[model samples]
Target: MTTLVAIALVSCDGPTDAGAPDAERFEPSLTGSAHVPYSTSETVALLDEHTACTIDTYETKIDCVDSSGATVGRFGDKGEGPGEFLSPARVIRGPDGLIGFSDSSRRRFFVFTREGELVAEVPLHMLSIFVPISFSETTVLGAYTDGVGRAFFSAYMGDVMAAAEISLSTGDVVREWKPASVPEFPECEHGLPYYGFPAVGGAGDDTWVFMGCGPGGDTTMLRAPRYVAESPSDRDVEEYGDGLREFRRRIGADPDVSASVREFSETPRLYFLLRGQETFDGQGRLWISTRRGRMESSFIDVYDGVELVGTVEVRDRMIDFDLFDGTLAVLVERQVGPDDSDGVPDRGIDWYDLGEF
Candidate 1:
């Protein structure tokens, strides 16, 4: 049951104009009081949330936490065995509340029950030369049959950059939509084609997809194409891609908004940037993050379908976030200097109570 939101396209303005309109502007409903750090026996990986599970990664092991922020006894350890994750890159909580993790190093999709039990590990070599799974928390992972499903954005060869869905029940590839029809991206000329995690909207009946990408170190936020329009002529897709690039440039340049384009290259042929990541409340609002520096200096915005509802300042350093049943959980790190671990800003688990908002 994949539903794509039909958005009415609008010319994007720079961030100076991206603020809340005077009429509907309400004080930021987000309030945060940090909790004591969960004493991790070891360091954790990036944080991902879903309806039933929240996952964090270590170098090779993954910790599964329940909604209460309590660690589940079952953890994912990577190895050659079945259900093992080898270099798991992303862990997403799906729309059906199922959990999905991509093992880029191993080239497989590990599907787990809410209880952290392994169910299936599907491979996506045909639809995607490699599947870089992002946004593992949404239901779209299995619901998309249109072949527009995508997971990650990376310039690295063998890194699954583009993906479309086959089915939710059985991990199958949609053969109809072959070699994903990505819009014209001029900025991806660098060795690494950058992409962000997937943001899904219009859940059950009306749904749409939005992804932001960029060159590393650039604070630009290029959005995905508006899929609800009439059949795009040859030029439409090109123009659409260009418009998104410009929109990203605009928002990245704004001072009130904490966004930037990052440029870190893993290989000589390419550079990298943090693509925009998202947290969608069960309803219409969305919380997106783009990075300016190494620290998680992120800005928050609320969106209903294509309309920007409100924007606010998220006062802390964060790397990733997840939302489910109206609860918003963020992953923050205490970044220490290169030489010393003592100064790493103490990281905590923070959840936003947004049911009424």
Candidate 2:
């Protein structure tokens, strides 16, 4: 079934004020232990209380491990064929306890058993920005953009986005909802049109969305059937084309830097300043990664709905992270120069026993 919801996206000071009265703080262990190298895809999910699965986009395969940190198996490979993934964008454990991989380049959803066995690979009509928040055999409920055809919806400023529920067998959007309506851009002129790209994470049938364009704290977090969040990218506002009409009037159609960034800064959020991502705990609480400043580690904010419940300071630069069943799997960004086998740097997936949060 499809549900239509309306929400207003608001700018938050969550990350800016980690010392708030409601925020619980901690610094987790970041030692080099239980490292699964080259399997640090942007997403991770748990198959069981101990078994965690993630995509090695570097190797173009599924990487799973048991409770003892042993290689369960490396399933799938680089191919356009079934059970093969051309570009595995996101990986999640389904409600039925199966591993699901979203291959954006191939536009197919691959389903597999927790034991690394392939079940089915269904096609999807969505693009890279449309992230599957909730997955099942029949349909995939994706959060974030629904193809506004804008030059850039996020750091180039944003457009309010509508979430879609697509069919698995047919690869069609069967249902959808506008996740949020931004009465105003999350950060007006400063981080408004920067660093924030949409981030999606989930546990089982539940999915959570975060819009982090710049270093700005909590933009908006949304979920289906709906959430009170900052709309992804919107077309309803007067600043269509991210204020290009006025920008061209002022700067001669130069770039998509909204209209105000010229008077402020000419750029959105730089990649060097922000490498942001998100995930969810077993209880379906949201874990979003943000940085207070350019540093070695990441500061993660845990939100239960709109309430800031807890926060964690990691030891390494976190590329992406996920939490389920009291276990946390983080894709840590470690530079090892280069790899001849692949053109990317060496990556690692660090597993932690963060029991009972």
Candidate 3:
């Protein structure tokens, strides 16, 4: 038997008041012009070119870093191993100092002790799942009716994100909820439009807010409607999915959009609008990597809710970003200076502190 609980959200103590300017709360200037010292001699290195995994490629295991840039811990390589990871989708630290990450491509969840010891692995139900990046320390007494499940015992999945509770002692999924298949966003059905990521939020309360993005992608700029699925129940979800499919068919059948729609459909990434990358702090904040601005240069935007607030700049094209423990960590590629004797990239990890912003 399953029971659904309705959840209500209280505004975060985040900077969202009338007197508080968005700039004051989320300052882009903190990252601009000024270059903060992120790496130091005391920084620890975890997984690098020498860590014995397939490290020749750029986007391979080069993505993981500690939240504070103080050290890099051991997350295994591409092959099968106790701590191994193949295309890690997301990583987070639970309250108990256990590090958890989901391998979307591998359909597994990994848990490790604070010292980088792998102790638990949980198999998942689907391969297309995008694992939720947030962690709650408390136990989940109920699954909220809203898109975001309520209670501390819950975790989320992506794209078709779901909220579920897994037993910490047994690694078993206690209760689960999945998004019923709705039609793809309508605008993409019509034009050769692109879509990236939908915005999502999880408050301290059980309220999870979700809004879809329409016809926006790595290159095109389009004003998209923001349709939200507030704290919806199982019955409400069924109805929403029906409405979504009808909208998709309507746009797909349009004669004017037939050609572009066909092309867009051919490229799954562009047509499906999988932003390719998504990040959330589990604290009601989200960031998406989208090509909606410049095709050649991908620009990342940060949001508190449905509102567009700021941008994350990767000036060197040699870095990526991740949200960790309420902070944003930037993985800057280790570069060799002209005077260095060894040609290998400098092995150092650094992360930006967003809380200070």
Best model number under lDDT? 2
Which lDDT tens digits does candidate 1 get at residues 1-357?
333322221212223332334313333344343432432211122233322233334345455554455655356775878888755654565545555666545657777765667767776554332433333332224221112223222322212233355443454654322222223233333233433223434332223343323321322233322111122332223323433344345336333212212122221221111332454665756555433222434344555655566543344555456565655666655444476556434555555555455
Q: Candidate 1 vs candidate 3: which has greater lDDT? A: 1
Q: How does model 3 score by TM-score?
A: 0.48
Q: In the order shown, what is each candidate's alpha-carbon RMSD?
A: 12.2, 9.5, 13.7
The whole-model C-alpha lDDT of candidate 2 against the native structure comes to 0.53
Model 2 TM-score (2 dp): 0.65
Tens-place lDDT per residue, model 3, 37-139, is: 2321111112222111112122334223343333234335676665576645444445454556665446567666545577666665432343444445432
What are the TM-scores, per candidate, against the unseen true structure? 0.56, 0.65, 0.48
For model 3, what is the alpha-carbon lDDT of residue 327? 42
Q: Tell me how far the alpha carbon of residue 88 in candidate 3 is from the true structure, in angstroms, after superposition.
A: 4.5
State which candidate, 1 or 2, has the greater TM-score. 2
- Candidates, ranked, TM-score: 2, 1, 3
- Which stretches of model 3 miss by more than 4 angstroms? 1-71, 75-89, 104-106, 125-130, 136-159, 179-184, 189-276, 279-283, 292-298, 318-320, 324-326, 332-350, 355-357
What RMSD value applies to candidate 3? 13.7
Error at 83, model 2, angstroms? 2.5
Best by TM-score: 2
- The global C-alpha lDDT for each of the candidates, from Candidate 1 onward, is 0.41, 0.53, 0.37
